[model samples]
Target: MSARPRPLLLGAGTAIAVAVTLSGCTQKASSEDGAVSVTASDSVCEVSKTELPAGHVSLALENKGSKITEVYVLFPDGRIAAERENIGPGTKATLVTELKAGDYEIACKPGMKGDGIRQKIALTGKDTAAERSPESDAAVAAYRSYVLAQAEQTLPRAQAFADAVKAGDIEKAKGLYASSRIGWERTEPVAESFGDIDPKVDVREDGLEDGQDPTTDWTGWHRLEKALWQDKKIGDRERELADQLMTDLNAWVKKVGTAEITPTSMANGAKSLLDEVARNKVTGEEERYSHTDLIDFKANLEGARRSYDLLKPIAQKNDPALAKELGQRFASLTGQLDAYRTDDGADEDSYTYTSYDMVSEAERKELSDGVNALAEPLSKLAAAVAK
Candidate 1:
């Protein structure tokens, strides 16, 4: 089974086009209000403008492609500044983020695969420092600290899981698998911003790109997952991949400090986490072998909550009704998810849930509906906070 669209933070230089266009009378990319228009189709990705003043920028994405598409605003180094994924054919969505004066690229993936078509863009003007408030700055700082803490905690757990896999202890590795991913699930958008790390540490078998050799190119948690669950045997390749996974994770921990995080990014990331749940976890595609989708779903919810809580003050002050609606929606979704808990334990850190495969279609629909209800209000968060 092919995996659903997975989030990517970086791409290889060979796969991306980095040419910048300084002068063109091509389609108008930016509106008078400063939102850049992006038109994505099977063969082309057109932006309204190639250069603009730096600060808060919005990309209004229209997916003219036949397949679902995703768009990314990337730093010159390939780090993701902001992205909007899972825009269905003929549908439209918006992505908002903060950018400083520098060179960047706007990339569109028609089928949400490969490195995508790239258009180099330049952001010229003053820094965004003058436009920000102390509260918004604090929210960004707090979210950064939270992301760093999750990364710090993730390493030891992931190390333990890796050690079990390398030792060929199938039962121990299975035991540690879902718990090990909690930190990563909670802050996935941040990990993905690094571009090179997420695919190495988390990509599934079906998520492999064209020309990617499974025997050699496929290396990550899912590779080891198939070994333990489907093959029911450990081999040299699995052990080697286990070690590689740890190396990639350690690099991710080190890179978190340099991620481009902002108030709008935090709000946007919170919504994206919900999209992850709706698109993959709810469909039981993420953990096909282990049936651990619920664990990931819970972690994604927690991560979104963390971002929302950090920005709640600013959002509340800006739009009280939207803030209240978001609060209720989050709580409602939390309640729905809590019913799946397998343990009566009060410790959230030690909680578990029924395997995703065991969940009925009706239950999944209810969960999906809850996510949609929350997502509608959550989508307004970036604009609310940016005010």
Candidate 2:
């Protein structure tokens, strides 16, 4: 909504090792080894200690700014090592990560906009094999397999949707739209690593590069969604967009194959999926043209739940009660979502969802409450796994 690429509102495999930093509310200025305290104010980010021992490190971040902010640990290669979002004014959150000895940057984004103010930090220590946990490794492997499987499935679905659009088959394209987006929504974080392709393929209408010049600038699934659901036809322009989408999706399939996955990221990805549901899906802001936001919400919830499931064993090993609560919360949220199912199919995946417009205000509130309930405990999962 602000500018290009839209506003900032927004490895692998081996059972990669991870460690969780146990954190709690603390007003102390001093930090313990393997832990740092971060404070975000008007324009700058302050760290209690910039140098950390390589292994597991926890950042206890407190937002002192009036607006919501986010923090990120940028790896040397520019990949994000860890990040925590939506730390509102006066709120605190913890980020835990396992790092090999390397140079990295700490980024604090105030007001959740722009490239965040950056600060360099160093991890100085010897590589310790003892830091790697078997539980963490297995969790990472399960999540990587989940993500790779989702990406593999996305290709054929995207191709089918694109083919339908290119052929000017309105009804077929409309039906395939939501289903096609499921894979992308589930593995969105990985898809986003492809740079501009993510936006070109998935950016919503509100996120169009230049909303003023809709004819030339508007594109992606929402663009084609509008053409199929509203215009009811795909002409040269829509066809061209469809072709480009197929090209980008093909590229995404290739990219996803090599996308990195780790335990910390798996936990963060789960939280992010819920954030997507809360930020846009429940508000009816995502599916303006198709009224299909619930479809995306369901997909996102599935992604979040899948991530949690992969981390559950480790989370349970560390904190059994917390893991049990998380499972119950997910089930509760799923039950809430289940109410929206139409009788169009008997299978869970084949069931159709009611349009958001048809949902009453009370129902929406219930949905929001359900998400909040789930998020409260879901938020603790990453730390639980790490510990």
Candidate 3:
């Protein structure tokens, strides 16, 4: 998986109304217009309001913290409704997401670690169901189905990989590793929304929480990757971690049906996928052990394409120029990625690419530039769909 506290960008648009107060974490209620003004410092997370009409909400986030911060809108059950990660110190960004009428919390994690400082909030008015058009509703339903299917397919592949690891079949485990991650790389936003699963299933070594002992604390695909590739052998501990990964993935598969899915979220998630490509895949930071980053890159692009294609009807109607540009950009980036393919005849799931370690720095730069070009136009997708 891509690194945690991943950088995110929301496209420019007319700001929606939601408010956050900057005082101490005292629970207060107010409904106000304009963007939710969120100020994150080293120890404080202040929102301008604790109450708002439920629908589309935008937070104008400014990070005052000395360390990078992450902000989340979370359901009471601990499921993340939406999140903006890697908000660097002294920088500002906007997070746009849809929320149904419910009680929730807005949490700010300074340094992008641990349970964060939180403020309780409530959304008044009816659920967003009546507010959304039938077309939007259909898009959400289709996306939910897609997400569930990916989760279902992932479980069996992950089981095979885990089984190989336990059997001490090093080469078998290595072969299964990249394939097992395909469904996950394709649908990470939904998986990450669960809050607890990503850390256990996908976290990289540098992404570990504070005070976590890498030996005992880290338990995920990347951990096993390190053991198989870097350490050059699987030990008893790797076997146990492999089993634990299966348990975590089972939980993710079971929970996929219940995840909050909305048109705006699907659009935003597509942009998030591109961001994943830029931050980790382009940098060659992801899949560093196996050098299978290209596989992940392709998966992320396909996932983003899936979301955009679903919402294309609405986007084309609302903003035809943007829709056209997006299509072209997606094509351009896809062409760039296709250049690295080692097996042209292979199916999407089984296509092989040049090992990332062998990718020249100049080639990496071209890929990065292509991703950035697509990402800029892709960022506008959420607002276009919402329109």
Candidate 4:
């Protein structure tokens, strides 16, 4: 048996990799009016003014906390409107959000995990941001619609996979695993928002503190993957893990429907998806037991492309040059991936890919170069759309 590679996530306690905050693009608060000042420290979340006239609001957040922290503007029911994650101590970042007249909350996550400390905020006057930028609003709606649709498709398939495992049908369960993961991978950030559930549903084996100690530390999708493929049996433990995964995924599907999708989030999500490809999928680290890393690679690329498509109109309207470059780069990357595709000759998304281990070194190098090329233009997308 081949030695399993470490997974992208580590440990049950590890936080989901959130969006890389757009700190570099922030402007000085002194020059920007209607900017709300927020100061975060070890113990509390402080907002300069809790009451404000509604419209577009900029949050100038400074982290004085010792640990890396995050701040979020949440809807009353905990959907994220805007957030800045991974703000190191003594650093500052800005998040601009279009808020309407509604009840809201500001949550400061001091250590970047758990339910955050919250404070109520009041918004007066009508929401002018929606009226001001109809394009942006439409983009958000389109992305949300896409996510909800993916969720609907994912739920039944995921449940079937779980059911197969529970019934001790190892081969059937194995076949269903890759396809069932598409929706979850595509809408990862929204799933990550439900911190408690993400780990249960998607945490990989490397995420365990004791990878060798299956009894004590192992659970979730990769746990079942290892059992079916490596141990070659389905038993009591497999059944339990499958049941838990389905439960978490079911709750995730319902919960993410309420998630707020914004242009900034769309941009950040695209970058994060490619980041997944570069950091883990390209390295053949994601599906070590199954040797299906290429499947994840394709899924991450599709996820990134979907986000780019959602924001393309706004991005083009904002910066035509950058937008054109991005489109071309995406095409280049797609063509490169097209080379490795199996003769099944189905659509790009449904095309079956060869195992990563089967590809020659030179082919892998070309694929890696293509990913790097896409990353260059991909990184600029968030700031371009935000501007």
Candidate 5:
């Protein structure tokens, strides 16, 4: 991929590629009395700058342009307070809310959602900069502790659910599985630790066969939560099936174990990635997700390796096989990365963003499909074994 964006003309089947964040904007803020106003346009959401007076100050959005606009108040912590949609131009709407001093983004268009535009509104009274307690290392530690707890609790529930379904205790298994889903949801943020099959039913991915095909549904130890809990009536078949499911699920969880993360590790990893994207140069190994891309991929692979390793101590571990498959897929990816090497034998140090155009579509698909296949088995493993 070249450093500069080349605009294609006519029908060469060409398209210009660039990061969407580099968009330009120029709009001014207007303020009158306690209310703030601005000329809204598609290009930018303009508003006043001197922070809102320290107190409960109401914001009135007056759209003077011709087109419809959406107004939103984004707090410093990335929480959206109030939003108005399809407000016609030459119309005024009031956003009755209070703002605390920090930083805020006021927007008139969803297109400019991440655009860091500020409508400095300051609320008076409390000098407290925090509505919630400040983030501490202890808090993060507690979160990790909570993840392990949730994982342990949910994995058993999931196993019980599977067993109940297999044992033909449909009602018992379904109720247990539904409760397990709540357990699984709590652990989702730390899911990368165990290769699938660890016995924790990942609510996001695995599901019981729910379509018109009855035989295909619940083929594996896991079944859809809704099917097990809400849809199916309690019966002996359900109990028997659930019991069978638990046998598989428990075995899997015992094989793979808890997810782990080092303190200050993830943040440092993110910074390394942003440093690369900041450079935005795409080439060589950097052409793909090498550098920042590679680091992220590497971290993910490390996570995969850990999960795979966790499964190593047990018999019938599905993760090792998946890990080996992933290794091969990664090897296949090396060839596609070769396209980025220039004739000069020098890889650009400024590699910030990788453009996929450097490789062929067939190659991209091949790698993507490989990753997907690897993930599918992992998902099963996690559902079957999560502990």
Candidate 6:
């Protein structure tokens, strides 16, 4: 609802998506190292925008810093073609550059900062086939790791922010949430180098954050936080909804340490939570946009459940506590999600100016039972096997 591009929430998510799409296949094949060598200042890459031809090339970057340095081809379209790492100050490191026919940039990161230092590399003709080459297997693996670390760091921080929200420290919660999001972003370019890693199935690989898409949809976990937690224009309408959302989220988090599991039990329970998230998807903005984007978020969460289910036997055999923890976390998140789908979510009080209505005792008990049932196999699995 703010004036900016929802930058705090979704910028990181959109960037990560492109990284996965482009991973591995971003560079051109290289047999030898030969590129137009340009000497850059400590600040800039010393190349104009239209300098490098749109084809295979390489850079032997010389870091003029006091410590380790890196130089990257920061493409205009968010494509990271090539980079050289650990280039010692005054020593040269070779980086192969494979560019397509478009405008591109080059920048040396942090230690050697001037301006973000821009360059425009233009391809005279089509180089899509040459440029979209498959990445080496190792490259893909490294990138996948980069993404997972990003997520692991982000999830906990977001939870902390949510906790602050639950405690009524709105300002503190907002600040923490912002800081947490910063962790998710900033390192995105690092993950961009990976080729061949698809996040949906690769738990090891970092999945793109959904909150950052330009189009109107809740992509990231905290994408709507800004809207819901703002000081201005947050009348009963916003505050009421915020409370509804958080109440569900809190209950979900509480369940994390206590959920029960087995494939059948987990599936039935998880599916219920999944339906809650799906049916309650926030119709925050009514703008017509890519339906696939909506479908993707829904599918990604669903896939996450499948992934958990596939690994259930392992949990059943070993690591039941993790299973309970994971199950509770998933359930909590889905329940919180249920609070957002204003139009279709069962919690109508958020969307309408209704009084405090509670879920039916029968329904509540069923959900509780479904979530906690997984503990049987999970506890056994943890006691008997390796996590």
Highest TM-score, which number?
A: 1
What overall lDDT, based on C-alpha atoms, would model 6 receive against the true structure? 0.37
lDDT of model 1 at position 23: 33
Tens-digit per-residue lDDT, 1-387, candidate 1: 125334344534434333454232135546666689988888788889887788888888888889888888887667788888889999988787888987787878888887778788788899986678888888888999999999999889999999999898999999999888999999999988887787788888888887879899988888888888889988889889889999999999999999888899999999889999998899998898999898899999999999999899999899999999988998999989989999885876557899888899999999999999999889888888877
* lDDT order of candidates, top first: 1, 3, 2, 4, 5, 6
lDDT of model 4 at residue 265? 70
Error of 6 at 221 (Å): 14
Q: Write the per-residue lDDT of candidate 2 for residues 225-250, one digit (tens) a residue.
A: 88877777779999899888888887
For candidate 1, which ten residues in a row score worst on lDDT? 17-26
> How far does residue 221 in candidate 2 sit from its true spot (Å)?
1.5
* Candidate 4 structure quality by residue, lDDT tens digits, 229-302: 88999989889888888887888878777775667777766766776677677777778788777777777788
Residue 134 error, candidate 3, Å: 2.1
Global lDDT of each candidate: 0.84, 0.74, 0.84, 0.71, 0.39, 0.37
- For model 3, where is the 10-residue window of minimal lDDT? 7-16
Candidates in order, TM-scores: namely 0.93, 0.85, 0.90, 0.72, 0.27, 0.32
**Candidate 5 all-Cα RMSD:** 26.0
Show where candidate 4 strays beyond 4 Å: 1-128, 208-217, 347-349, 360-362
Superposition TM-score, candidate 6 onto the true structure: 0.32
Which digits, one per residue and each the tens of the lDDT, describe model 3 over residues 1-387?
Answer: 555533221222323234444245543222244777878888998787788789888888888879988788877667778877667999987777889987777888888776787777789888877777778878888989999998899989999999999999999999999989999999999988877788888989998766878988788899999999999898899999999999999999998998888888888888888888888898888898999999999999999999999899999999999999999999999999999898965587777888999999999999999998998788778778876
lDDT of 4 at 284: 75
The collision pairs in model 3 are 19-49, 20-47, 20-48, 20-49, 21-47, 21-48, 21-49
TM-score of 2: 0.85
Q: Looking at candidate 4, what is the lDDT of residue 71?
A: 79
For 37-69, candidate 6 gives per-residue lDDT tens digits of 534444445432234455545454555556544
